[model samples]
Target: MSGGPAVVTRFAPSPTGRLHLGHALSAVRAHDLARGGGGRFLLRIEDIDGTRSRPEHVETILRDLGWLGLAWDELSFQSERLDLYTAAQGQLADLLYPCFCTRAEIAASLSAPHGPAPVYPGTCRHLSPADRRARMGQPHSWRIDMARAVERAGPLTWHDAYAGEVIADPLAQGDVILARKDAPASYHLAVTVDDAAQGVSDVVRGVDLFDATHVHRLLQALLGLPTPRYHHHPLIVGADGQRLAKRHGAPALAAMREGGADGHALSDALRRNMLPAGFRLGEA
Candidate 1:
């Protein structure tokens, strides 16, 4: 069968600023895949970090996409759904732990020869209520009890459109944050829960998310949700053959919008990398 979307796909972008080229590529590609498969294209604003997200940035993002003639049927924001994120955290709380180590401490531990950066030293994890309460006034966040979550998740598997097959072990990834002590929740918790609630069946994102997908897959398993097919699409790189920065993306997409890129031109720009046969960007 020709390459086509098998289920509902999404492009969840953080509304921190204007959509960049990398963001546009991911969004457009996911949109195309969904459309091609006769599916729906959903947009979710990852506005969990309220400090960075602004109303102006959100407006600009929508305007930019509208300029390109891309439309979505559904939209959501992570900031609005704190209750759902908490429920997901609760599921992990029984098995989850709290992490209070700062960045410098983590850096010092990782600097030691303990394999590829000791995935979370597992410090400050699984603290007693007394221990947890002790830091109530101090700045503290919570982490999932990965050990128990993994056991709860059981064996899991998923197929990737580009990477073929993917399997993960949560223990290796270590315990990631579920809720920041100060913030309502962490991104891992928000995205996992949101995807489940939206009933997203396929995750079409950039290749850089390959590692994060493992963690996401673990969350899906832990939550007892059906795992979605993953497609780690190639990222659009710049002249240096690397993923373009947020600033760089702002200009690229802006220029595209300014050049009267109705529909065809935007499509052409996105398809540039995927069109040519035997054309690999950085592999050479």
Candidate 2:
């Protein structure tokens, strides 16, 4: 914990599944970061995906974190913050365009011969005003014009504890979705907005989101939000060297808690980087 304003960190997990050891590692790290700096730890339920987010899963998350001897200073649910996200999107209206391309259409476009690092080919980026107006009745997602956005917010950068200062290159990711018909806000938009709203000064999570931080830094500049110092820690992996997930048979925290495992002992082990058998931390 470096010297700065009191650190406010969050463990925002989607309530689509149970909390596993990997999730435990993230939560403990965030908790320690906040507590170590005499700051606040927030428990935010990223239940923006209405279809997949279940109330039971959220309950299990609470139980799991509690069983691990972790406590949060505040709690929030993304489902209740739709209005804030919508307002944030409105502020970036000039940089956004409606994307009419379906998943199948985008996949087909990417399948053709293209650059080594494939991204959205800007299929709907050049639509005429009349064409866009005519398609207003159809379902579509709102995508940010990456080139225009980059030009508007020039020479953006953010600091990471591990990666150091990073120059933002959001253009490589193409026009990313801000809003969709199925969801009021995309992951990128919602998390950026929520983090700012919560006054999170230190973002501690997995290194996998390092690239996404580039886009987030740009968004913070565009939206006039503060850029929080980031710490993208390594991910916990199983014997196969794959990140822990339900598909990989990662044991859920609830299961371990229910099985009479010592919560504080497990928490201490994770803090000391003592992983269970056949598990280890890996780089992104």
User: Which residue pairs does candidate 2 place in steric collision?
Assistant: none
As a whole number from 0 to 100, the lDDT of residue 90 in candidate 2 is: 96
Q: Per-residue lDDT tens digits of candidate 1, residues 182-203? A: 5688777787788889878888
- Residues 1-284 of candidate 2 have per-residue lDDT tens digits of 56768989999999988999989999999999999998999999999897888999999999999999999999999999999999999999999999998877887877575443357789998899999999999999999999999999999888999888888888878888999878999989999999999999999989878878888988998999999999999999888888988666689888989999988899999999999898999974
Report, for every candidate in turn, its global Cα lDDT versus the true structure: 0.73, 0.90
Models 1 onward score TM values of 0.86, 0.95
Name model 2 segments beyond 4 Å from true.
1-4, 112-118
Name the best candidate (by lDDT).
2
